[model samples]
Target: MSASGAKTNLHEFVVQENEQVAEGLWRMRCNTALAAELAPGQFVQVSVPADASHILRIPLSFARADARSGELDIVYAVVGEGTRRLSAMAVGQASTMVGPCGNGWWLPQDQGRALLVAGGVGLPPIFACASMLAQTGVGFDVVVGAQTASRHCVGYVDELRSMGIHEGCDCARKVVLTTDDGTLGMRGFVTQAMENLLAEHTYAQVYACGPNPMMAGVAKLSMSKDIACEVSLERMMGCGFGACSCCNVALVDGTQALCCTDGPVFDARRVQWQTR
Candidate 1:
């Protein structure tokens, strides 16, 4: 079930624009009603057209959703056959998608600035989270990372910077870009930038989406500081809903939860990072 208490449904979507945004990364805009229903951190299961034999849908999270425009932007990496096929889809092509799946990021319980960390394609949800914060008059700082300069999305960074200028927002926002190969702003992991920020300033909450190891590191740092943190986890889902049970997330409580339904977003402390 979605946060709005509605059962997931198949929605028809038309591709508006599908083009390469960064090396090996493609940004796609789709016209669909699902845009209004989606919350930050939630994902959609899209059935790639022209592949009746391939039953599995590609699960993707959106970078932006404009309810008025009835459009959503998805930033995806061309990793395998499914995504490669998705990249080939032409503008005006129509397809079916199941959404708005899973829970989304929750606002911080206490009032203070928050920190956002994103790596690679993880930038989408993190960008969405920043938008949510901006709309609610919450202040935030961002750290975006990629393997190298070519893999980074400068457009999202610019969008994040613009959030600092929101009408009611009074606090200054800091946006940091990091690349492992030292080809960009900072040379090192997002964690390294996060560490420096944590040391210099205090934050009420932290939000992150990235590879397991990177998120684990973020969770550890947040826990040590006694700060609340939320992380969006990625899993392979045969069924985007709960039926297949392929996307199990091990919790610290010795139980397993389905990532597709229970969460793609979860409390950082509750997850068993070792299992990931």
Candidate 2:
């Protein structure tokens, strides 16, 4: 996931669309040339003007990016003031965005079958990766989870739609959804869904993003099976660039790694699960 594309810097972007897909969850689209420069698994640090009290920019993954339209889609769950401010943005409002940052997922050359595990708001980068994989005819399956069935509506449906994935879509059967309360496709977490898939399919690789606990399980599972795996890490980041040490994460080597630079994505085997 080496940084690629145009120079990364602050860019003025106007909100093209903003809509709430579910409780406290929003899907925001903004017009910016930088969208064309973004690679799958990368993130943008956004400054919500309404949050004058918070100086740190909120990091968000690219749910979808249309280089031709110069529109970047950001799917997020509002957990605090910064994100609440971000969700309030009205169409045409402007903000400062810096990104296309962080080392992203390692795409395999084989392009064989792969598994994608997503949980809660971690769907963006994984969704972006799916889009690219589908375009290249890489056979893949997805296991996504949320707290409840309703929580599953938070841009997951729309995100899949935007990617041309639907009930009747070619990859429809490959996508599985799960929830904690039996309110969705399956009544369990994504890990259970992944376990079922692994039993029936032989995947060449695994890609995952989500809460640390969930990712830890996926990483552990992948490692147990000796399957190559990559994980996108989530951390509180202030600056989009490496200058800010706020997003540092512990590594397997007993060293600190910056999620904003070294990676928001890393080989699953390289992460130190205990430290998380």
Candidate 3:
């Protein structure tokens, strides 16, 4: 794939509403003309105008994209100037973005039982993939972890209300929700939840997107269990497209992979996870 360039109406979207889904998590839906074209595991790079303080682009993942409604959704947390500026923007303002960049998180055709695991802000990309998985008439399970129940993203069910778009997936089913603080759901790290599930059921393939520790832990478990796994990476970016080379990371095979080009999603076994 080549560098993604800015194009007119290229899924460049306007903020419809930015609501707090969790304490730091904000669900920002974009008003786009091409929401329908985006699939699961795919992400969009958004340009964030920093608070009069600086200039930078915030690379974000597509949590959910509604093609029929011309709406795209992204769930993010306030980490710095770029996101803060995004939070302050009023509805109707447009964000300059380039996407469905990188590789998407799609399940293999013969996956007997697929597992989609997400933690913290990493949950967004899984949401997009879940929608796509549902379309394939395939059965899959989802696992989400956070510090507390309140930290969970929008689509996840919270006892009385359903947060996601699809309420009834085939008999595939789900068993997730782990918290470190016992504030809500299971009181423990998400890995604990993942381990429990893996012990009970043998998954054909597993996919994950989250913090390095979380992703690494899952990869280790999957490796030991001989389960196929893939992970979506998050990195600081200047341009959402590949032009800036800001999202580049070295793969385990001594090869380079641009998070914007080669993948934001890579097989868990091949990622070289280290803080730079």
TM-score, model 1 to reference: 0.97
1-276, model 3: which lDDT tens digit per residue?
Answer: 322232323456788998777889888877886566565676665776545455555667777677679888888899877777778877888767766566677567574877888888888787767666666655677788888767776454431123232656445476577888987778887788888888888788888888888888888889899989988887776666667787777788988778766777888778876634
User: Residue-wise lDDT of candidate 2 within 190-242, one digit each (tens)?
Assistant: 99999999999888999999999999999999999989999999887777687
In order, what lDDT does every prediction score? 0.93, 0.83, 0.73
lDDT of 1 by residue, 1-276 (tens): 697465689999999999999999999999999888888989999999897889999999999999899999999999999999999999999999999999999999887999999999999999999999988878899999999999988888888999748466477889999999999999999999999999999999999999999999999999999999999999999998899999999999999999999999999999999834
After superposing candidate 1, which stretches have Cα over 4 Å from the reference? 164-169
Q: After superposition, how far is residue 183 of candidate 3 from its true place, in Å?
A: 1.8
TM for every model, in the order presented, reads 0.97, 0.92, 0.86
Which regions of candidate 3 are displaced past 4 Å? 1-11, 49-53, 158-172, 274-276
Tell me how candidate 3 scores on lDDT: 0.73
Least accurate 10 contiguous residues by lDDT in model 3: 1-10
